[model samples]
Target: MSETIPAGKGISAAQSKIENRLIETVVESFNKTEDPRLKVLMQSLTRHLHNFLREVRLTEDEWRTAIDFLTTAGHITDGKRQEFVLLSDVLGLSMQTIAMNNQAYKGATEATVFGPFFLENAPEIAIGGDIAGGAAGQPCWVEGTVTDSSASPVPGARIEVWEADEEGFYDVQYGDGRIAGRAHLFADENGKYAFWGLTPTPYPIPDDGPVGQLLESVGRSPVRASHLHFMVSADGLRSLVTHIFVAGDPQIEIGDSVFGVKDSLIKSFETQPAGTPTPDGRDLDGKAWARTRFDIVLAPALT
Candidate 1:
């Protein structure tokens, strides 16, 4: 025998039927997609998106607000500023994508977000040279070695480094087309590299746009811990993009705004008094300096 439904239950069941038909129609529209992967992706995306809308009983106003926020984020993006990447970062989507793509490897350095600030074709600097370019900050000596998984030095690997100054400003922030605290260098025959850079200081992710507004609405701080960025690459090895975070930085303990910090990537920066001999023999004018050593291990490239 057929069961009778109450009046409210009947209405709900009819509404659910309409929702299911809409989802099914949207998903079926992608059935003719040329790429198998794209077809699957579109179908899955439609299903999940429809489910989320139903689960939330989303209002039209809320959906419109989200659309407007994303539109504003795109409108503000330019050559030196990337608001979309910043949004992904603050939302932790960037780190989640990185983690999914970069599986852990024994002895290889853990990868982190390839922040929006990386510039292509950065001017190459000689070993032990100063990358700070007289930018304002305490003198810091950065020395490191590049090796393979087996611990053998991988000489001649390319290392690209960039960081903010003591005042917590990147070169791009100045908008003067001046390059500071960023350079490319190569490891020596013994896989050793050293350069002079400024001590990294905590700074906010460019929070002047919609992403910033989102952070404010969520009661979240926009500060990133002090860190030096690196992109190391060698032939026949998978490139490593990562950062060396300052040990004991309050932001690191509290959590980096971009979710990029890994406990394994933190290293202490030792303080040296003024007049100490610099590792690169560059004259520091008797200024007190900080120094740290980082070693990198690369994994073999997938064939």
Candidate 2:
């Protein structure tokens, strides 16, 4: 017998007996799980995890390192940052989960990963109000209407929006307790909504943590594509979480680090030279601005 188990060599009844017995022992321990779904999940997780360890011939040192990595991820998570979400994003698991949960239903807007920056109790704004709240970036005019799958306007739908500023940092990244570049507001009776927001820009996901180290070990970039986030919900409709990517962003062709981009979500951001009249006649003081329209269609909720 070699020092390491031979890759893919068939294990005999006696040879694998000990390891297989251990797997069965662990799986059987979950038999008392009261929830049927939980019991299946635990047993399946045990089987797959054991199979992976056997296939990869993982060492004690590697297992220890993985435990340490998760510990660090948990330690760094808080009100503002989520290292586990970053871990899941980089591993493509986040997008996979989103895809499974938000299936296609009529003309419903495509759903994407809910990045880690969302905060509850965001201050509400009125129609044509500024969601930017003074985050630094080129001003943009965003307008859209919320409609149901049947094409009827969903009056009073709630929309929450957030994004990183021009410097590639969200408001929560600052320790001074600043709030900007995010707000929630309701659609008007006509299902129309509009707000001022900073132009979305490409930025790297926070890279000073364990998730960053893992990405570095695998030679993967930590930068996310330029895009704006949106979470729209209305009574009796499936809530949608998605983003609109700038149509010409070079990163889209390269790749979104979180695998959150979709062709249907890409929209042109019309550039306006300095002195262009604002949508609501707000003064830009000679600074250039941009505008984009995103009409959202939502799917029906499961009863």
- lDDT of each model, Cα atoms only? 0.88, 0.91
Off by over 4 Å in 2: 1-7, 10-13
What does each candidate score in C-alpha RMSD? 3.9, 3.3
Model 2 TM: 0.96
lDDT of 2 by residue, 1-303 (tens): 112233356766565667777788888899899999999899889888887898887899999999999999999999889999998999999999999999988878999989999999888999989988888999999998999998999999999999999999999998788889999999999999999998899999999999888889999988899999999999899999999999899999888999999999999899999999998999999999999999999999982
TM-score of each: 0.94, 0.96
Q: Candidate 2, after superposition: displacement of residue 136 in Å?
A: 0.6
Displacement of residue 248 (Cα, Å) in model 2 is 0.7
In angstroms, the error of model 2 at 183 is: 0.2
Query: Could you tell me the lDDT of residue 196 within candidate 2?
Result: 93
